[model samples]
Target: MNGLFGENLKYDLKASLVVFLVALPLCLGIAVASGAPPMAGLIAGIVGGIVAGSISGSHVAVSGPAAGLTVIVLDSISSLGGFQLFLGAVVAAGLIQLILGLVKAGVLGYYFPHSVIKGMLTAIGLILILKQIPHALGYDKDHIGDMAFEQMDQHNTFTEIYYAFIYNSPGAIPIVLIGLLILFLFEKPKIKTHKLFGIIPGPLWAVIAGILINETYRFWIPGWQLGGDHLVSIPELTSLGDITSLLTFPDFSLIADPNFWLVAFTVAIIASIETLLSVEAGDKLDPYKRITPASRELVAQGTGNMLSGFIGGLPLTVVIVRTTANVSSGARTKMSAIFHGFLLLILVLAIPGLLNKIPLSCLAAVLFLVGYKLANPAIFIKEYKKGFDQFLPFILTVIAILLTDLLVGIGIGMVVGLFFVIKTNFHRSLVVTELNGNYLVKLQKDVSFLNKAPLMKQLSTIPPGSNVVLNAVKARFIDHDIKELLDDFIETAPNKDIEIILEGFSNHVRQKA
Candidate 1:
């Protein structure tokens, strides 16, 4: 056990660092989007990294405030009358999550269809692509949390694109172009083969290059600017004393408001779903094929959120973006997760000023690449080869997610997949056999209520004055509803002048003659 855990610890450190780098700007951006102090996001990241990572059973999963929850936090704060009150709701949500974890409610995660999950990743990818456009072009009017195109306007994603192009700030163009070029060059397969180049990820390189270009341009041009508004900025903290003062307590007074409960419930449900999905996906990506403990993950998340709420932070979950980064970075253990959290804490305490210099456009470039990889065309080709049963639902899920929001799209795709499953099972069982002018009805094994329609149709077609034999030798368990339907059919068969004989029974019972 020591050797196994030791190996994992080494891998976790490397993976955690990669996740930390990816998470830094995201944490700040999401916090800014929530209309709370920028430090709130950082606090959540720190807590999620340290508190959550330490306890979570998910070895490769990384926890932090998610962009999907920004809108929820914003609404909660507004309705609750203040950010502190919203923190109270978050604490309540955390308690709920803890209860859920203790009760082993995480099993509900299994019911989510695979197609829907794929679709969610694809939809989130598409949203990242859309949301990043303005940042890529250097437009910083909205925070990173603005996901829906409709929220920008009344129309769809295309309309938002048209407006951004017509009204975007030109200064952002140069920085965006440079960032994109850096991303493109780093992704070249030839570069990845080189020993030196392979050591650093494309996102890290793009960010470094972006920082250099911005600093150089500022030095030479004097009055020229690269649109500082399009960059991430850390909240100004002059001293350790100031940082201490920034922490806010949850306002228990808000517990009296019904809206607080509503928001807490919403946060708990969504966070659980997102965390479970991330756990499943992260486990699939693990090289060791290790299964993560889902209920334990909830407890970890709950603990982190509770701490975050008490200390002026947003709710968090096991985010897919950071979890994927952890896996790709060769992370093997929970130690890496814990180390990353410590890193966040150290960075925030030591260098808030330095972190503020990173450009939002550069981060957008990283997310763009991440999004593309998740919804790559290669995945479609791979799924297609698996046959229509797999690809059809997957494609529908992708399309639905892109057209609508995550949950709605997944729900629609699941319904479609379930329909196909039922239809196929029913069609495969309706076979006919003729023996001396009598019909032999052979039902498939494991027939259930889903097969009732086809079974009834077959029973109705039995010829008058012909003997009908019901076969059950090959059958396993039949649903009680189906058994009752067959019994009803036996009673009604004599009225149709058919002599029904039951096979595989002690007595050869016939329909009343």
Candidate 2:
């Protein structure tokens, strides 16, 4: 244990604390969005960090309750009758994922296009910035938007800005401005090398500042004070017995229920895809450039969910926001992720009141930086410069996800991307170069049916009284449709008063025509 973590234990400790802070509000927000018990998200966060991190192949991919699965979970709870019954579906989903991992089905994650993944992240970042604006202005809503355009509140995402502008809190605006300033200065080259600011993480100081600012309002400046509704609300645990009571077991009798199987299958597939993409994203951010073992990821996620379900936790997946925060904080090993779990467990039990005093606005500031890093304008420009093929799919993905859901958005992008792929292949199949009043037709080694229309169109443009040369010396495979077209063209050559020439044609092909 020491060998794997001891070399950079200090760095891991710093990163863990930063990640823990960033994850706290998101966990609470996602749980609220899912319509489960508030503690359910916390439980999933702990298990994901401890169990999944312990076994996961990637050093920085952190698992927890995902916002993407919120809609499915919400609907399942209603369809399956209640939260306890829904736990059964989660358990079933985990078992199915275990089977999939055993069969090496995790590689399905690799088939997704890179442009689609980047667009997915970019859309999430834009959503993050847009949604957090309300919290940053202190809207004081119990249910925060969970990184989606179609919010859980049944309102479009733009409504959040309306709420922020109308219901803005005086106390929070200052705290957020101060928090953002602190983060900005902390990142500056001058402040980074300072003796004190360099050692302690910027997030810890931000939390402390938030706490102090709110406390000042609560006591000394009661005239403009903020209420508890505006702060983080972690349920306080008064006794050791309180911890055990939070655990809830699933009703196993639902195993025979067909509806349970349907929900389970849906969750398993969606969770697997989200986890795989997050793992790939984390790998891109790895300074060491190491590839994660994809198969091991499925096993770890299945194990975490099984345990989480048994204990009344929300579904778990690798989350991109926290994963990016982990990278930003300079996490070196999986120990940083595991340690963050332990920190979550300790703090939720030890000082729920202290945590509750933290204003959501400060946390929003932290997330704003993370969001901008993911959706950098420089990246968008670079993608555009690559070519329209890459940029178009990326733009489509971002727009679709911003207006609809994740799966649908990615599907739209993939379809657009596939069209470009087929188009490029069509151009390469057969070449027609005209010279000296004659047309030279050079067929490539392999040609598919997709090229037939283009090939036929080019052949038709051969003006009357012109010569034609057909070359297939390097051809290996030709579709029957293409051969038929060539045969028909050859037989009708006399009608157009055009000469016909065939070079390197197969004897059988020559004889058949």
Name the top lDDT candidate. 2
| Predicted structure 1, TM vs. truth | 0.88
> In model 1, where do residues sit more than 4 Å from their true spots?
1-14, 152-156, 167-199, 221-224, 428-438, 445-450, 465-467, 473-485, 492-499, 503-513
Estimate, for each residue in 194-253, the C-alpha lDDT of model 1 and write its tens digit. Answer: 578766666667777777767776777644356567667766767778877879989999
- TM-scores of the candidates are 0.88, 0.92
User: How does residue 300 of candidate 2 score in lDDT?
Assistant: 90
Q: Count the backbone clashes (under 3 Å) in each candidate.
A: 1, 0
lDDT of 2 by residue, 358-447 (tens): 888888888888888888898899889989988999989999988887778888988988888877766776899998879999887777
Relative to the true structure, how large is the alpha-carbon lDDT of every model?
Answer: 0.76, 0.84
Of candidate 2, the 10-residue stretch with the lowest lDDT total is: 504-513
Clashing pairs in model 1? 12-336
